[model samples]
Target: MNKVVLVTGANSGIGLALCERLLSDDAEGLQLCLACRNMQRAHAARSALLASHPSAQVALLQMDTSSISSVIAASQEVKLRYNRVDYLYLNAGIMPNPHFDMKAFFKGLFSSNIITMFATGEGILTQKDCLTHDGLQSVFATNLFGHFLLIRELEPVLCYAGRTSQLVWTSSSNAHRSAFNVEDIQHQRGTQPYSSSKYACDLLSLALNTHYNKQGLSSSVICPGFVMTSLTYSILPSFPAFLWTLLMPLFWLIRIFTNTFTLTPYNGTEALFWLFKQKPESLDPQAKYHSLTSGLGNNYTEPRKMDVDLATSEALYEKLLQLENDVRKKLKEKQKESQHVMHHGSFA
Candidate 1:
C-alpha cells in the first residue's frame, strides 16, 4: 500500500524541501499532496517534483490556511481524493512585516545573552500583524487556528482503528512561552504574534495527543531552526540578496557556536524528515523536535522539552474549540444572508 502525505505551504522553503526529500526517500510507493494557497506556485512545485521523479504520485490542493472556508473546502476535497492521510504536515505559516530591532541585537551582542539571541532570534524579531476577514488575527489564524480546523475537519481520515496517522507541525525555535497568553489566544494586542502563534501550536499539538492518541492519531511539533528562506530574507528587506550572500561567512561562524543556524531550507527540514521515519507512539508529547546543523554542515534532529504543561494545553484546546464553534456559526449566518439576498433579488 502507498503511504499518503499531505503538506501545507508545499510550494517553497522547508515544506517544499520536505516534499522533495520524501520523494527521494520513497519515490515509488508514496502519494504526495501539495497543499498551497497559490495555484501557480503549487503547479510549479508539482512540475519540479515530477521532473525529478516522473513516476511519483503527486497531486495538488488549493488551501489558504489563514482562511476558514478554504480549509473546509480543501478538507472536503482531500477526503474525496484519499481514504486515509498517513501523514499531515501542518507546515503553512507566515511571519509578516517583520521588524528587525538592531538596538536589541546590538544590546544582546554585548550582553551574556548573545548565544541565546543568535540561537533563537528572539529579541531581535517582531512582526506587525493584521486582522483577517473572520475578525481573527492573521498570524494566529494562519499558523494555528487554520491548521486546527483542517485537522478537525479531517478527523475521520486521520483517526483509524487499525493504523496510526501523524500530524507534524513546522514550528520554530522562536516559539516562546512568554509570548503566549491564555486570554489573548488571538494575540490581537501583542507585537510578537508569530511567536505567540507558534507557541500555541506547541500547546495544541500536546492537546491533540491527549485527545486523539487513543484513536491511533498522534501529533508532534518540530522547530526548523534558523533557516534562510524567503520568510527570513523578508525580515531585512533593505539588505539585498547579494549582501546576504556576503554574510554567508558570518552565518557559518555563528553556526559554530549555535547549531540552530541550519541556514538552508533543506537543512532546516532535518527534524521534519526525521519524524517521517519514526514511530509516532514512541514520540514525546512535551518535546519540540529541533533541526540542527553543525559547523561542518552535519544535520541532525534533537528533541527539546517545551515549557508547557497538561493544564495549559487542555485550556488552549478548549479555547480553540470554542473559537471554532464561533467561526462556524458566523460562516453559517453569512451563508444564510447571501441566500436571502439572492432570494429577494430574484423577484426584482
Candidate 2:
C-alpha cells in the first residue's frame, strides 16, 4: 500500500513545493492530498502535480483551517477517504495586517543583534489580529487551534497500534518566548498574534509528543526561516514587486552571515522534505527543525532546541481543550436551535 500524505495550505508556497518534491522523489510509492480553502486553487495545484507525474495519485480537499466547522468536516472527509494518514503536514497559517517597524529595523542594523533581527524578524514585525467567527483570535485560530482540532478529530487514523504517524507544523523563527503567555494563548491583548500563535505551536508540538508518542503518534515543528512567500511579502506591503527584486542582492548579501534566508519556497521546505524520510522515533521531542540556506545557496535542515518547557505546554494544552469544548458546545446549541426553528416556524 502507498503511504498517504495530507498537506493543508498545499495550494502554494512551501506546501506546493513540498508536494512537487515528494511526487518527484517517489511518484509510485506515495499518495498526495492537497487541502486548501479554495477549491479552484486546490484543483490547480492538483492539476500542476498531475501534469508533471501523470501516473501519480493526487487528491484535492477543501479545508479552511481558520474555521472549526470546516476543519471538522474536512477531517471527517479525510477519514472516510483514507484508512490512515501516514503524514499530516499542518502548513496552513496566516499573518494579517503586518506592520514592519522601519525604525527598529534600522536601529537593529547598527546593533550587535543585526543578524538576529534579520534571522528571526523579532522586535521588527508585528500584526493586528482580529476575531474569528468562533470568537477566537483569527491568527491563533488559523495557525494553531484549527490544526489542533483537526488532529483531535483525526486521532483514530493517526494513532494506531504498532504503527507511526507524523505531524509536521510549519512554524517560524519569529516564535519568540516573550510573545507567548499561558494566560493569553490567543494573544488577544498583543499585536504580535502571529508570533504568539507560532510559539503556541512549538509548545503544543512538545506536549503532543509527550502524550501521543506512546500511541505511535509523533509531532514535530519546523521553521521555514525567512522564506519570501506571500506572507513575508505582506510584511512590506508598501514595497512594489520591482523594489523587492532590487532588494534581492541585499538579501543574498545578508545570507552570508545568517543562513536563515531560505528565501525561495523550495529551499524553505528543506526541513519538511527531510522529515518525510526520517524516522519519527529518531526525531527529538524538544527540538525544532530549521530550513537553512548557505551563502552558496545550498539548502539544508538543522535541529535547534526550542525554549518551550513541559509545564507551560501542558497548561496550554488543557486550556485549548477547554476552548474546544466550549466551541463545540456552542455549535451544537446553534444547530439544535436551527432545527427547532425549522420544526416550528421562525415567528408566530
Q: Identify the candidate with maximal lDDT.
A: 1
What tens digits encode model 2's per-residue C-alpha lDDT throughout 1-348?
899999999999999999999999999999889999999988988989999999999999889989999999999999999989999999999999989999998899789888788778888988898888888899999999999999999999999666899999999988989999999889988888988999999999999998999999999999998888888788898978998898788788889988899989999999999999999989998999999999899999999999999999999999999999999999999899999988788565
The sequence of per-residue lDDT tens digits that candidate 1 reaches over residues 23-47 is 9999998999999999999999999
In candidate 2 the C-alpha lDDT for residue 236 amounts to 90
- Score every model by TM-score: 0.97, 0.97
Residue 290 in candidate 2, Cα distance off native in Å: 0.9
For model 2, give the 10-residue run with minimal summed lDDT.
339-348
Report how far off residue 328 is in candidate 1 (Å). 0.5
Candidate 2: Cα lDDT at 111:
94
Identify the runs in model 2 with alpha carbons over 4 angstroms from their true place: 110-112, 346-348
